[model samples]
Target chain A: EPEVTQTPSHQVTQMGQEVILRCVPISNHLYFYWYRQILGQKVEFLVSFYNNEISEKSEIFDDQFSVERPDGSNFTLKIRSTKLEDSAMYFCASSEALGGYEQYFGPGTRLTVT
Target chain B: DQQVKQNSPSLSVQEGRISILNCDYTNSMFDYFLWYKKYPAEGPTFLISISSIKDKNEDGRFTVFLNKSAKHLSLHIVPSQPGDSAVYFCAAKLGGYGNKLVFGAGTILRVKS
Candidate 1:
């Protein structure tokens, strides 16, 4: 079965640095999303992307955060400036239909900010 | 405020026994609910779900029961196996938000053999 794939399984960066997490969703999926999980906390939605634009974003998705589908298969989340609070596991997900099907998740990328 | 909640932090069940996991939510607008399973170092895997219009949904050994009036839901795994040991998360989908889902703190289930 096809699945969403994320790169850089683990990353550690200093405070005030930049980091970009990449994901390749299932080839036929049309909607993509980014979520984060702080240690021992519930998973939180960050942003949703469809048709190359952000459909909706949570308050946690602020100025420092941006998502881009630079090509057909790659979805990326870039953090312009990282902070200690930014340390978390970033997950990427995709769905074949718009709110009609279950979204498949990829193995998350653990981002650690010192 | 937490829209979805799984008050239990962990549960243990013996092999071949039935395991019941419960969840509650404060949001009324949420029309869809789902359950996910996850192991260490991996993202959550879809388990089963139920729409608010229905009271129960079953798939193989997994079943999800939703009580709209009580704002509560439960996931039942029959004849649990060791492989079923993992953290399970309950999530609520806000229909108006269009695919945006709010999740609860996961319940770690240990199915001992």
Candidate 2:
């Protein structure tokens, strides 16, 4: 079965540096989302993207965060400046439709900021 | 937070036994519920889901039961096998488009052979 895939499975960056996490969602899926899980914490929603615009975002998705669908298959989350608290496992997900459909998730990129 | 809650931290069941995982939610606006399985170093994999309009949904050995009145749901795995061991997460979402999913702390299951 086709699955969502992410690049740079593990990323290490210095605090205050910019970083980009990339994802290639299931080809035919229309809606894309980004979520993160700090160690020993529940997965938290970051933002949702559709039609090249942000549909929804959480407080954690502040000015420092931005998402882009620069190409047909690539969806990326860029953090303008990384903070120690930003270190987490960032996941990308996509669904064929909203509401009742289940979103498929990628293996996730582990971001570590020091 | 705290919209979704999985009270159990871990569970162990003997092979071929029944395993039940329970979840509770505090948000009534959530109209959809889903269960996901995750292994180490991997992302969550969708297992099954049930809409608020339905009380139950079944697929293979897995059956999801929803009690809308009590704001609770449970996932039952019958004849559990060792391969079924993993961390299970319960998630909820609103009914409309672009709504974010609220996830509970996952419950770890160990199906021993």
Candidate 3:
């Protein structure tokens, strides 16, 4: 089965530095999303992208966070400036169709800030 | 306002027993519900899903029952095996396009032999 692929399984970044988390969703998927989970916390939705534009975003997805489909198959989430609170596992998900309930997720990128 | 809530932190069951995980929701606008399973250090894997219009959906040993009136849902795993142990999460999609998924805290299931 094809699955979403994320790069840099684990990242160690400095505070106030920029970090880009990359994901290559399933080749035929049309919708993509980014979600984060703090340690021992529930998964929180951050943003969703489609057709090269943001479809929906949460309050957690503020000015510092940006998502771009830099290419046809790759989706990227960029954090303008890392903060201590930015430390978490960021997951990327994709679906074959819109308005569908099932979304396959990637292994996730664990961002650790020191 | 957290929409989806899973009150149980963990559940342990004997092998070949029934394991039930429950969830509650505060939002009525959610039309779709999904359950996911996660092993340590891995992303969540989709388990089963139920729509607001249906009260039950089943697959293999897993069965999801949705109670629209009570704003509750439950996932039942019968004849549970050791491999069935994992953290289970119940997620909801607000409406119109699965844009975002609001997730619950999750329940850790341990099936012991």
In terms of DockQ, which candidate is strongest? 2
Q: Please give the lDDT score at residue A33 for candidate 1.
A: 94
Candidate 3 vs. truth: CA RMSD?
A: 1.0
What CAPRI-style quality would you assign to candidate 2? high
Best by TM-score: 2
Pull out the clashing pairs in model 3.
none
Give one digit per residue, the lDDT tens place, for model 3 in A1-114: 899999989999999999999999999889999999999888999988877888899999999999998878889999999999999999999986745668899999999988
Please provide, for model 2 over B24-105, each residue's C-alpha lDDT reduced to its tens digit, 9 standing for 90 to 100.
9998999889999999999999999999999999999999999999999999999899999999999998766676899999
lDDT of 2 by residue, A1-114 (tens): 999999999999999999999999999988999999999999999998888899889999999999999999999999999999999999999997534369899999999999
- Per-model DockQ: 0.73, 0.86, 0.77
TM-score of model 2 (CA atoms): 0.98
State candidate 3's TM-score: 0.98
Per-model TM-score of chain A alone? 0.97, 0.97, 0.97
Off by over 4 Å in 1: none
Q: Cα deviation of A68 in candidate 3 (Å)?
A: 0.7
